[model samples]
Target chain A: MKQNSLFLDRATIVSPHVNGWDEFLASLNCQDVISFEEDWRAQLESLPMRSRRRLSPQILLAISVAEKIHETLPKETAWVFASSVGEGETLNVILDALGTPEKAIQPLRFQNSVHNAASGQWTIAAGVKCPVTSINAHNYTVGAGFLKASMQIKSENCPVGLVLYDAPLPYPLSASHKINIPLGVGFALKPEPSANTIAELKISYCKTPNPMPFASLPQIPENSYNPILAVFPLLKCLAGSPQEDIFLGLNKDYGLCIKVKQL
Target chain B: MLQHPRTNNCGITHSSIVTCLGYGRSSHLLALREGRSGLSNNHGLDLQFDCYLGKVPDVEGIGFPSRVADFDNRATRLALAALVTDGFEQAVLKIRNRWGADRCGIVLGTSTSGVEMLEKTYKAIPENGAMPEDYSTRHHDNLHAITTFLQEYLGFTGPGYTISTACSSSAKALVDACQLVESGLCDAVLTGGVDSLCMTSLYGFESLELMSKVPCRPCDASRDGLSIGEAAAFMIVERDADGYLKLSGYGESSDGTSMSTPPPDGSGASQAIKAALERANLTPNDIDYVNLHGTATIVNDSTEAKAVETAVYRSVPASSVKGAIGHTLGAAGAAEAVFCQYALEDEVIPGNTGLIDLDPALLPNVSESCRNGQLRHVISNSFGFGGSNCALVLSR
Candidate 1:
């Protein structure tokens, strides 16, 4: 197979229970499936001189995780940010505003309601003017984001950063769909093989119902709403078996085949 | 920096259009030729402001197949309307059988995914004091609605997703689709955009005071603001080198500027144009025409004019079809690209519809009259809020 590979030099994961890859590594050693918890407002206080009310939870958590990945990552590099259900908290506010016809719509919140708000904020905050792809593909969002970044790495022959984040939606919207834990994953990728290369990735995208399902994250439900979970299989391949080809079903028919190799 | 602006084995093998001018390419091209506009008074839109709107009529009258009734929405309806025309659906079927269903992907762009349905639900919420039992925003307002619907509709299981970068969504979708093909993730992709008119945008643009009272006038000296519009446009982009038209290059950039205001001096826009041309490995002189992202706003027209001036040195025939179709926002990228596809095949350069009193500051390249000529290469620009910008180069 002539599939291209990208070096994953640095990475980070943020959830309620886990802080970074080191924590994940610890959890793997202990064989524990920990629950996630975090004080979003406190973590976001790290960023300077920004109002929080205008920003949604997804954008805040996303930027926070991205900031942790690379404090001074080049803004000129391309970015791919993906989510399954974005800004559900603000959606509830919007619906409340709609309920009160007299209540004025918060112009700032309304403008940032679009799916790409996080990407825009990342660019504006970093003051880097470059290409950005904001995606939302239901449960397939994380996989879609990775596929896009992998393609971009091959096309641009440059390093690309991927941020996949989503927060639990407040009910009654949550009644039908529930994502118990809010999670985010950040990855720094490059085209050329390097010392930081974590794996020789042979990634493929297609689905004729590949019966092989990669083992799911221990604590995470099989049908979790967290799009970030899509990358778990890759992480599993990294933390456990790093020399086998594993297939993960992104959806009913769409799947990702990643051959992971340890550094 | 980029070698040959992205080598590609794909081109626009088939396409379809559904806008205020009605369905199909002929209807759209005729308006482009005659400068006939689809923009009319925004009376029924329930807005107090005086604004012109280009809205596709009979959206409610259009019917989806019963099997896919659950996916019915204004945006999907518009997409199906186009998918059924120009043999687009037939082409998709033929390709699926040849390449296998899992070998194709569906990527769509939209600013208001199903927000219109949300607007309807919210309108009823105040009266009912609770969400309607049937109020399901999953199919109507979810960001993945169109992508999921198309995947289910086509029965294809390839990589599918939706991109929403305001007006630049669909243009970026094409870029994403091209990558999918280049990465061997998929063999063929249905790439385009669909955004149905809703109060969210109608009042949203009005709130920003970006909507014009009269019809939009692109590049016009007195151009004040934009005339908002809605449409659905798609092109069956495949990894086939046989098509006459070729998608040579694409460039993407961000202004990192304010959400509403574009970067002054055209630096952000120029970057994208330069990137596309750089990848195409051609100088500005090689471009035969430019499809401007001319939304008729005083700032957009002047800024884009300055950008075109800096990007293309020669006086290539340049125009903005937004004056005819109104600014189709998310779909405008693919819409303008489709217009360019027909322009290349017909060898006719469409005049800037609403560009009457061309800005004197703009070099004399901006044309107001349509002309017949041999066309080789053309580029379409789509820039949007959040400082998202994109440019596409297609050649014949």
Candidate 2:
């Protein structure tokens, strides 16, 4: 575990309540509930119109958070994008079209339906040829993505970017898989600590006798379900300082134990 | 495919595959060695045009244990069938006992998971846009359902997840599984992929005009498009211990070029291949065989040919198992890894099953029939949608 520790260079968050790290910390510090903001979408509008037009909300929010962290990341950084049910809206559109008489599936929507669409779009937008992967662990997506990123940093010995995002599934399907809030969190993690490092984290896997429950978490709006919300505790820890190691529920029987040190 | 030092101490202890070629590694090896193809006229789905499909026989016929019965679906069923094959289940249990259940995690890949159930459920909706109360999206509709199902069924309690990068999904699973063991995160990881046939892919490819009207003829001048297939390939990658093949090296890259189309120059694919070679401590000249990600799509085949030419010698024997089993999509990587294993174990290069009228501009040694040869180091390539690419190197 000592060798697995990596530096968290920077982090970004986007949701209805907050759009960046400072805003997130402010909301946590104040304990005030707030409404959704369109700032993330507004920021994306600055990109080329051709790329932004067909982008799904899931991708837009994910890219917004990633773009925030990308500015300070190395150009060769690899990316790992995680989501539970990716492009749910896009899938709804396709499923709806499948039942229609025309059965006319939009070419772009079909292409975007893939889980890796957001990662691919970011690569093209950033003109990066670095390694990339899209991950899904149902509700365990954040744990899975973070594990991949940290392992990549250890194996490749380079900077790795992790983006976790999920939007509400369109109705009907949404009822079956409940994720009402749209959240995206990006982290720029490195193999070595530097002056810009915000936190140092060492991740280890263990058979958790009693996995931490969501009820114990700090009250954040809509944090009960969304897999992207799994990062909240770690984020809160970085924002301030926590004396104990954080145990995140990855599954029913296993957990990702993170020891974080504020730097 | 970067300049990192090679890491060792992990190898594939056991594996199982269920494809149109049939169940277990023996069936696939026999088919590959005999130049037999599993493609037939499309009958699994109702499509408007003529095409061939690598449909597994009686996927719905496989019964599940009562513990996992509720989680049953086409994808999970496919995985269940593989889990019981080739002694893979026994291998997993051995590893679990050796390194506690929590030390054995699962990391799988899939393009479209058990979405077939969702498509079926959607068709039966009562117009209220609400799923049936009994439907378990957590076990059947989600991408990680397969992983969760397998984890519960196998009693693995470690870090389990699924990677869904379109066609390159499972290939990357092998890469991650190797890393999990090397990083000391897990003693062993059950890795591979399972993507069953669904309307999403059948119609999705049709929308993109990437479906073929006949059996896919990979690397053939007359190749029109791909023939979508379904499969589940699972393998136990563990630390140390004697195994049949070593996962020597792997490379992954995003084309960052296009969603559905690979870059014409194949630069992304070349980079992955070169990085794999460098990590394996081998040069292009040391490669014995290459398993290509030939979907038979015009651009994909041409671009992959260019990649092989630039990264590996054009003269090295390379063949795509897709022509034999159709494009297994997410399963292609692990399935082809099994093919690479067969090439190393049996020392035979799989034939290009549907390939005739070979493209004049492609590799010179795309074998039209299986040939016995001495094989040591082999590479398998899997490039997916969003121009995601992964190449893996395996050695005997």
Candidate 3:
């Protein structure tokens, strides 16, 4: 990896466990047990009703996180959206529709079924025409997204908005698909340190026989399976005290190591 | 800080493709040279519509290497078929040996990775119970299945992922590959895209009323819509390597206009095209030929025409191979990149194969027939659903 470090200018998480980044950090360290609820739907009140109805939970969660980050992001920030199975809920509906004799599918649902649905919808809604990409990296989605976003920050010299989300598949499909919870994380990565910088991150890639275990937040139960939370350990580090280097496995032989320093 | 000027160091040493036009570079070249269409009447899906399709013949029967046979699907099979062709596998092995597996990354693009298998599995789902015994989501349904399967089969585990930006997926994958090498992240990258035809896209496009009953005639006055095709194209890109073709530059942009269409002025497309030319440090005049992303849909053709006009500031010889290969969606970008590579090598301008009466609005830009020419730099445009636009500049 290059020596140039990325600063987390703005970071947030959308999940059933926490409402805001501050609360997430506080809950992580709090000894009292906290019960978290899903409030993403209520947050969608700001969007048009048509979008709210048509968007699957995955897209809605992604857009919600993006909207939160957009408040603090630069005007020219590029976006990199990552998910293991984008719009899986929409796909399940389409599959079910296709299996029927009528084989009728809604035009809106069909249009929103592409993997870039969240990126497309968010960009269109925000009227931001910068460079945007959507990624699907399976188990390594978060690491892959961070690497892609960091590379853009390094090469293009532009702040990049990174959003990663994963929602459970519907019904019998869910049995096959591993993720069972709706979760998302967003970060605005800048090439240089800024006033809003949460941490300075140095990213590198290496091959190791044993990958580091995923970091978990005490507030959320069974949080390791969701792909988006792969960065939770890094988030935990950013939320509180910085500690050991975090390794994000890209594949069997190689992975990305993120060394963070609290700013 | 000065913006990093895009580099032209990544060279494509070897590439392979499996399109409806047939397998390998030679087959596509012959078809492009003759202005022949590979599209035929749609088969197998039993759709209510009457559109043609650019289906690769007998992809289902293609077998996989036994070691990774568990990950077998039509898309991966199609990829393997192309991977072994044109010595692409041998070339990849050479690169892998020279630069360890960890140094060789894979970035693939696909709109429908293994959706066909997913559709099949969905159909075979036991009534109210679980999925069939053999269904594997990781191997057969996920968008990353193609890259995952290839890595498992070929024995490389570098930083790899799948980019799915509709039609621009593979083209963007190419851009990511270039960035990986330029950023010193990897020594060599396997970049390309694969998409197999499935019921989802067919019926989905049909739902949107974008399915052309007849073979697509992009840039033609009476152009109706697009014919969905299936293809897999792969390439080995290395930094500052000795090769006939180099990825000179690339630009990606979002329309931020609509999920299904671009704005009338084509501002988003123009941005990508202009960015590509600027990154390449070339004037519009430097571009020898243009591979138009002419999907035959009326709005797409006219807007793309204006976008090209706005960016190039001149009328350049341009054609859309969609008429020949059909709209390959995610694979279209990489497939067209290979087409651009051949154009650079053979000095031939691919014809707008399905054009009969050119839309007067486009005027003089759209080529009706394949022609030979002196070529240096060419641009391939891929604009996908969700207003995703990507332009790639390739040079010899």
Candidate 4:
């Protein structure tokens, strides 16, 4: 399984206004990429749902990116979806029903309660027949899902579509979790590499008494523009300024380091 | 043939294999073996009916971690108790060291992630959507709270993920773990499921008119509905050279028919079971026993029974442990699989405790009391919402 893996290519995220990958990266550094009024107004018209509050901006961003990346859909790629807070809107519906006896559980909301609802929705949207998988690993969700997708590609020798997205929770749930981060979504198209490739990823495990310090790992620069927020750093490193490796330090001081070298 | 590095990839391996050194739920077992119903009438449930429940007794001071705890939730406490038991601590440490905290991963399956906590938060939310400081962080929507707590406690780092596919969650977690190992992703994996009694789940089932007022009797002719209970069970899965119970085969299928309903003819479930048997390269007769996904719900039991009978091992002796544990939801599959391993080791088939007589309509291998015998292989079925089904084969 030492084949050189390629990211192939990805699509440009489309938003209601003009907020794209560059704008998103700029916003991370406290720059207003687009006016709030313009974005909100545009979102109001384009979204399927009526209410402004129901749609989290991050979810919109994620959906936009997903639509783009999946535009030239792979006929035979596996789908892996990762989420931290799953279907925040559905939670609100269930809670609202609990508050009202006459309301009764909405059949649609009930169906959306399963954790895999996002993947299901994506499958329908993408019209892909590949095996779809949804996974939640709390904060480490994206990493875990990525690991699974990577393994699938290696074992099955097929490309994989990895989508990670999380929406801000409904007020009470959102406020309680103390997760104030704006909505975010990331998608990666990973395929096994060919011979004589420049970059490679090797996942290894070592037992050590002290846990690895994850905070010390190099962070993606604040200025890099990428549709996928999570993998922006790796993308930047891959775009020419090659790093030998990027390490995701895990518990027990264990590290899953992705080693890369330019040929 | 292409010779890959064989990087000890995709499976578990270690100097000291983490194992389930002991099981302390025999007291619950003792009560079941004697036919004493763990189900009781409870008014605390928010549902309209005065239903029966298999509530853990005398758990007054069972405090969930305040950060993630909702006073009424029982799932977290149960998982903590299971993980803190005598051998569990050592096993956690051993796995942590063997795979390295960063390289170790935890995968859990659950139908409800602290829904009891969510219920409390729902009751207290202000009309304006304001919430108490800790309301959002409660364990309910933090799907990985348990895994996060476990990761921090045990210092495992590989990959932590949770799978929620209704009843088949834990079994699906096992499937995911095996894939992870087979793909050379992680060295060791901890896979299991947990669920607790909550108004949302209990009442949801009750509203569907699926809760049985009396004890649940799986594969019984007169069986009515399910008796919801709470439990958390985990197993350490590693690439082993001489593992006791090898996860020989697994197969998963999806029936897009409906979420809360079972597939009409059990065709989906049958496919999964047959696939597992075929993957293991063993005929149905090779399986000594079967742990059914017998939720006791009318459709579930009947459909599952038919599927098992149609499976390659049609005549193989089978029983649903739910009769004893009262349907532990997500934990049902993992818990029963562990029980199956024990049954294989002890050579005793625990009786279908609550089933007085086998249902004539449904054909399955049913029995009473523990039968002394050598069980070599077992197939466990777990079917969940949205027609998600998984079958796993564990061999001694």
Candidate 5:
């Protein structure tokens, strides 16, 4: 089958360590000290208290980046948001309220608990009637979001806005899967072809026929702790070049390899 | 093309596709026929609800590779179990070899993807901002875990995606898969869904007061709520061939009302079902059985029951399997569709296990156990959060 004719209009990343384009690019360095506290402060101050209570900093960062890249109102394009730690902070509040029977469940928090809450907020904020899909795929969360967006372009022949975001884990629960990096949000404005031409997105996957080339990269031992290091290859591929045919290989062993070309 | 040319040949054909090819539930037909329930009480720390779950029994005894163990979300295990058995591996291999991996694709749906792992991580994070060593490598964020797993297991290099629209996730996945095939994007597609028991889901449902304390009884007046279960169901959906069950039609619509509650009138669901029938070039009378998204929730049951009555032929037999296996969340659509296929193949309508007497005020097709009949064309409904609705029509 011929690959769908979809183009990446723009891609944006927002995190506590960076807000605008330049800062986001710089924070890609592993040494940067990105703090969720600082990021959340900036995000919370921008929204009204009511909206703040309903939308988390992670969601806000994602929407802000997506809105900037898409430039169009949310209503103009279909929305698909992907997340790993979805509304964990809000869930914490709900669990705490449940602990004390005197505290009735907060309707705002309750409404925000659904996985699609971020997409809903984006829809209302954008005032767009386009469909919104919210998905969660633990490790492949973003990749899955990208795939779905691609499929929509092929099957529905419509432009799609893809948003990927995750916040730092809340306390207690944070102890389970801890990350020191600041909250992260990535957005790609994917548009369908208007005319017969330009670059298109093509994705493929295959089973590993031979052993993977893990030996090429520096091994981090068997149980080393890393944060987004594995995905650096994919990010680098997307950010480093303006290429036509970008090949993202998520190994059968779950390792990822990215190759790009300018056609 | 806005609509594919092959749209007429796409749908959920059987009243139920019940094949006992995996580990979770044994004797799929026998269990439903005898009204046997598969849910057992789970005693995990994160799980707060004292309820029954339709968990795959004796899975721990199966020796999975350590690498596979590292990706230990219940969804992966269940999907692998289903794919490795029942000639699934051979089928996948055949397609990959013939079409090339890139020509084969995968579309899976699930409401939760290893959220239990997230829950575990959340409980471990300290205030100092140090994560566990395995957090980064964990496949928790990658929606492609299942796709990658299948890619590795089956060696397919095709497009892959994970649909997450609450309970309707997998049902919609199947619909998307059919569309992909009909559009000529792929010669074959792996469509299914998987979800496991987790604290986030349990508490989330319990907080809404939707979890039933006792076993679930769909269409019964005495039924109070739902029993949350865990499962993974998959189907190798290919283009219409000589022996394959032709996916005749599919329809999807969204209401955008509320995530937890469906539209009171079942308009969105009815629209999807009707659209599917229209796409299949069939009338309500052509449907032999209707497998409902009967979660047993008061509002869901009432609304879905009404939709089936209004949209389907009056004489079509309709029932919900939640009575026997509990609500499998993301896997419900594919799992139930499998049951519908089995009904068509076996020539029997498995009874609605736990319903002793249908609600007097509800529609008339509700019944207690499977009935012997010549089943052929069937419709399966899967409604999810955010008012996402999907209906599939399959024919033998």
Candidate 6:
């Protein structure tokens, strides 16, 4: 296995407990756990009212976080946007329309129903035109996103913007999506360190004979089915210790383990 | 695409495709050679529009092996149906024995996953505000459904993820699989996509006025819109292939212009094409044929045509397979790339299906017939919603 190092130049976390990365780090405590609501929306006072009116909570969260680090990124930045269940509410709306005889659907609703809706919104808002991959891997969305973002930086020698976010699915669809808290996290990952770099991480694909258990990690929420929340432990380690190991539980048999050292 | 040299080549060691044209690579190649359009009168949908579609045959009859019955869904069944054919399953088993399970991985892409199941769940919601007992949001409509099912069915787990950037999902998944292999994460990776047709995509496109009332005529002056199709295309990308097409290079670009409409300048698609060419370390001259994204839409065809005309080698023989397979949405990337593989093998460039009157705006390279010739490298383009675009360069 090869060890690839990525310097986390800047990151922003959006959850119920904290509004930005600085707040998150300042408020970081092992015992203090916070839960984000399924459709949490606060006054995104930084953005214009016109822009705020059109975006979903998850997209808004992504933009808010990306805005914090987008300036540090290159003009043509590659992005890997990952979410477990994307725009489930929008899908329900479209599904309801298709279920009827008339099948009258809205154009805007169909546009937002795609899994990459947030990626579209965030890119337009940020005005960065490189490339983006909107993806998901069950509860492994965070680790998968990091793996994808890190690989893009390593292989292509480019700075990558990684965003992991998810909101609640609507109705009977919500039955299987056990996520109680909707959360999002964005990072500007680079191959080399910048002045604003916060941490350096070495990622390796390790053979896990017995996959790591989520129950061992207390920072992870009980009802947190959103894969973005898996990054919470990594953030906690970055905030507390110099050297730490965290397994991003991507699937039952495999995951990405990162060794994070704060710069 | 970008023209740069790569360290090691990723090969299309094994692959399978199941569409309305038929199952297996030979079936598709036969249909392509015969110039058969899979576009047929739309059935199995509740839409009122008179558009054509490429429907997978016997999708309902596609069932799981009794061992993997619990992971059954329309998408998974479609994937397994293709996997069981083309010796893909046997190949995977052999690769597993050679590399061990931990060194083999799978990544599948889907735009709608189990949205059909979501529609069913929408119907079965009780008055008491309870979901149907059979409905599973996690296992059904979630993006992980296809990948999870494949991992469980195969019982081979390494690093896996699902990409869902509309049409470019599977192409990007192949790039991701190549990286996994390059990073020493896995020796063999199942990289492709499976997106089934559903009311959401059908009616959704109809709402956007993107659905054509007839079979799609890509690169044609008579073209109005696209006949959306359903498919499951999978390929195992590994090293040391004997007689397989190589995944030499790939490029991805986000238009950053519109959600649905591509940039009129065609620079976004050009970026991907340029990046892929650069990575392949080949000029436009090196690319013998290109399987265009040709969704038969007015704006997409014009923009992509212009992009290839200027940025890529305009003289490169290009044709859209959408006329035969219809626009497979998320599966289009892998579907078209596999079509390029078969095209290289057969030395026949697929004709622009449904094309009668060629578009005046298009270059002469868009073929009207399945011409036979010596072919080598081919470029496959897949542009999608959210402005995400990916281009892959394949070599024989």
Ranking of all predicted structures according to lDDT, beginning with the best and ending with the worst? 3, 2, 6, 1, 5, 4
Off by over 4 Å in 4: A1-78, A101-103, A120-132, A155-159, A177-228, A234-263, B1-25, B28-37, B42-46, B63-73, B94-103, B136-140, B180-187, B241-243, B356-361, B368-370
Candidate 1 chain A TM is: 0.86
**Model 1 pairs in collision:** A16-A36, A16-A37, A17-A36, A17-A37, B4-B279, B5-B279, B114-B140
Show how many residue pairs clash in every candidate, following the order shown.
7, 2, 0, 29, 65, 15
After best superposition, candidate 2 residue B285: deviation in angstroms? 0.8
Question: Model 4, residue A92: what's the lDDT?
Answer: 65
Q: Please give, for every candidate in the order listed, the TM-score of chain B alone compared with the true chain B.
A: 0.96, 0.97, 0.97, 0.88, 0.91, 0.97
Better of 3 and 5 by lDDT: 3
lDDT of 5 at B54: 61
Candidate 4 lDDT score at position A246 = 52
Output the lDDT of residue A177, model 5.
44
> In model 6, how large is the Cα lDDT of residue B75?
79
DockQ of 2: 0.69
Top candidate (DockQ):
3
Q: List each model's interface RMSD.
A: 2.7, 1.8, 1.9, 5.1, 4.9, 2.4
Better of 2 and 5 by TM-score: 2
lDDT of each: 0.77, 0.84, 0.85, 0.61, 0.63, 0.81
Model 4 lDDT tens row, B264-321 = 6887788778767876778888988888888887888888877887885556787776
Lowest-scoring 10 consecutive residues by lDDT in candidate 6 chain B?
B1-10
Native contact recovery (fnat) for each candidate is 0.46, 0.76, 0.81, 0.33, 0.16, 0.74
Model 1 regions lying over 4 Å from their true place = A28-39, A45-47, A71-76, A206-215, A221-224, A240-246, B1-5, B126-138
